[model samples]
Target: MNKTIVLACFLAVTMIYSCKKKGKESHPEVKVVFKKKQVVYQVFTRLFGNTNNNNKPWGTIEENGVGKFNDFTNTALKEIKDLGVTHIWYTGVPHHDVITDYTEYGISNDDPDVVKGRAGSPYAVKDYYNVNPDLAENPANRLEEFKALIERSHKAGLKVIIDIVPNHVARNYQGLTNPDGVNDFGANDDKSVAYRVDNNFYYNPAESFKVPVFERDYKPLGGDNHPLSDRQFDENPAKWTGNGSRLSQPNFHDWYETVKVNYGISPDGKKDFDELPEGYENEGFRKHFEFWQDKTVPNSWDKFKDIALYWLDMGVDGFRFDMAEMVPVEFWSYMNSSIKTKNSDAFLLAEVYNPSLYRDYIKKGKMDYLYDKVELYDTIKHVMQGHGKTDNIPPIQEGLKDIEHHMLHFLENHDEQRIASPEFAGSPDKGKPAMVVSATISTSPTMIYFAQEVGEDGSENAGFGKPSRTSIFDYIGVPTLQKWVNDKQFDGGKSTEEEKALRDFYKRLLNFTINSSALASNYEDIHLYNRNNTEGYNDKVLSFVRWSTDEKLIIISNFDDTNTYNFNLEIPENVIKKWQMEDGNFNTNDELYNQYSSSLNIEDSKGIINMEIKPLESFILKIK
Candidate 1:
């Protein structure tokens, strides 16, 4: 071969090899064990590290105080990691609409009529390219502050996840830092058209958008005097509201602050883009991503894709999508497929409340996990509160048996009332048995809200947020969390005895789940069999068995909070055979605390043990 031709071939191979090396470096090898159950700790970023005790109703930032990016110091992240968490979901990081003025920093003033509270709702993202200024010590360095927190969290051995509200953007969406040549949402839209495949948002032709009329004495900033609190907003040819309100003048109860994004689906429910073929659900993300590479999708699809890639470039580990079901499942397939190609280990979780849509969102949309709210969480809550029986549980488990691993379980989140609240179980201890079930009954990941361990009852009557749920809208300090913070110590120094004990229980339970191999593998419900055969079994108790090649676990939890039950707990003969046990006596040790023990007698190929379970007690017994 000629020297010039040979040299050209060698250079081509070297270029290809260099590209491959860069790809590997771009997506670093994350710490992941396939099919291993993970624990997620969701902490409201601006609320997690706040040490302030002043929580006034409808208070300003100075009066109520706010948490910031610096609040999540190395010390704070370390405490969260020690709780057996693999991922820390930092909620409310993006720049959202706020009442605070940052005119000096070149940020446009957000009218109070379009903002949720003094601090603003995290879901109403104002700029996709910036971090919330309220979360920074210096408004100009907000993005850098958040990036530092991300690095700190990673160094502390916790992956970071943030929200991606795909259904909508803030009504006053701005792109102060959008990269050159990228147009903001609706910047090039034809306002005369109601729906267009290429348009970024759904428009209402010839109409003007108005702020929601006040209902029953409601006012912006609680009637405080602000130049923008005139009960008026300006939008010609008003866009559709986030929650699908068609009215230009949305009701006070509507999501008026956000405008829905158009995903190429027409107003008459016709698709304007190509649909995936029949068997695409079973295909891997690479194939799904490749298929869309040559297809022309809606403008909103590309817009959201750019935002996701930008965050991924900034070293974000994953996203917890809000209101995921509102958007088409096909969009998730396209968006999440792109995400997975960039970081194959990206943890993609979504809030899909509809049971029928769960599997589609998982298989078709490439979602890693979906909230198990409609079934497992709801059933467990019912039984814990003494409103339902354990008998209701086995059926739900049986129905979801095929996809159990894809269902993420949790007892408390930002949207739910606290377990210690009067509206809930009214005691932290009441959640112990339920927590065991939620965390250990399946192979899915388990999530705990920030302060759920020590029990923040969400009973504060902070303005814009009443009792029973933490206000994602207002700037306020979490009282129970502050005790644990103890002035940024993150040591729980001022926590009460009851709070300390509850936190210990959580630490023990969560640590065990991530370390145990059996939890992520096999499972069988022994509750039904024991209910019919056991001499003293009742409807208030639940029993299950989890096993793998490395270990075995028999979990039992008594939901009855008033009485200690002395019952002869029995495992079915079939379960004993499945465990390959011989007819003999085996010592039983509690894996949770290692202080409790009992004897399991296997007779005639059936396992039976004497049990004295106290009220709200749960035991993870390992037969040795």
Candidate 2:
């Protein structure tokens, strides 16, 4: 049979089985398959277990304590797993430039002028082979400590993911602990040229690098009286800034702490590297790796691939690529393909904001998932802030229908503001409805930042770290999350009643997401139907349906924060026909809140649902 006819026959069989009796002994057994929905919990490694109550602005490491790799004990990992998290993204695990002194451990001290804060920017990686000394109980055994943490996470049924900042490195990049025969970046570069395919970085040979001039209330080392805080950096033949700024003296706003890596892409948008074959997308990563074995590619690509494989060998489950779009897609195609060759199940997530480049990065770059920041995330934020309507969601889903599974959904991460912050919705309650929609609207994985469940209001004034985002650049404790930590108990002993309730809600939602078979099945939008048929159903409400052969769910959310809504939601005829439902009265139970029970009347191949939804409430109604 032709491919189209084969697909039609397969779908027809699926529909017939979908309408089978629930527990009919006479019916033949049919296996139901579902892609497990993943819930990722991101924690800044330095701050996750820090019990420091003294959060002085720009405080020294001594004043403000830091969490060590050993802090993620079995108890801690178990708590996280119980919260229904499948993956733990350990941010800032790699050795980066920090203001703290680690010279006693044979590590070089970083200049205060270039570092962002006392802890420094995690993206400005200084050593790829070594773990951060600040996170180790014993500085010399840092790598071992991290490996142990990875084992612990895996023991608790959680996978480990660390950052792979391929686009840039610390200005003073040095791999002192590199394995034998491994060379540091720029060591073999011919620095005279402005750009070279083999050179690891772009150099400006004519001028020396100057430190950016600090403005406003900011200063080098937060105005602390340090000898090296003289606004002078020693770099002969300055390199390009991480943000692609070519000026020898980059502005303070530019990514001045790090230098961009050269990936065979020229300054004028020219590609100097080999492109993937036209039919390469259909091939496996092992094939791609074999294709590059004999080819002479850029030296930087080889180095990154080796780094990724090293982590994979050490039990690291995956990597979250930083600013992946900034680097060339062809290089990612080469690098990520090599990573998958080593471990095919390795989760490769990229941060790519440009919508136009989404498919190119996923298909050509071999990325498993990319942040849905510019579209779904931005739209959800706008609706939460009372600026946009719920009608914007269905179109976005339809537009990315082919690639929705590849687009990872998240309400907050390291780069975004907290939901409880003044700049966002100003309260954690506003996130309930948004999180419901973000988690259930697609088959994509959902990520929640550390302390997001208990409402960590990122309102601290830590040096070099502004409010609205937990300071990744400073040694600071998250207030709300600290309560749950309760000084390393990993229990909510000190959390307020409301905070505990919020965390419980998150637990329920995330656990349901992972266990729900319908989440990974077919989706049908019911927003337009309810808007047209149900009176008093405003833009604040959104509804959809997800169904598989064995499971069906009607998800509805009320985005409004003030008034409760009572309306009759109409289920479209197409959805009823797709599910092969017969005309009758069906009983439905809310899976989210089991106390609520309702009846759906199916007539004329359509259904009407009577719902009395509270403000910011959501329902996952299971049809019976």
Model 2 over residues 15-40: C-alpha lDDT tens digits? 22212232342333343333668899
Question: Model 1 — TM-score against the truth?
Answer: 0.94
Model 1, residue 161: distance off in Å is 0.2
Enumerate clash totals for all models, in the order shown: 0, 0
Tell me, what's the RMSD of every candidate? Answer: 6.8, 6.0
Question: Which residue pairs in candidate 1 have backbone atoms (N, alpha carbon, C) closer than 3 angstroms, thus clashing?
Answer: none
TM-score of 2: 0.94
How big is the positional error of residue 595 in model 2, measured in Å on the Cα after superposition?
1.7
lDDT of 1 by residue, 1-624 (tens): 333233212211111111112223222222222256789999988887677778888888888788998998889888888988999998999999988888899999998898888788999998999999999999998899889988998999999999999899999999898988788889989889999899888888999998888798777788889987877789888999999998999988999989988899889999998888997775657768888999988889998988999999998999999999999988998999899888877889999999999889987898889999999999999998899899988888899886787899999999999999989999888899999999999888999999999988998877887788888888888988999999899999999998998999999999999988888777899999888888778999999999877788999999999988888888888888888989999998998889899999999998889999989999999988
- Predicted model with the maximum lDDT: 2
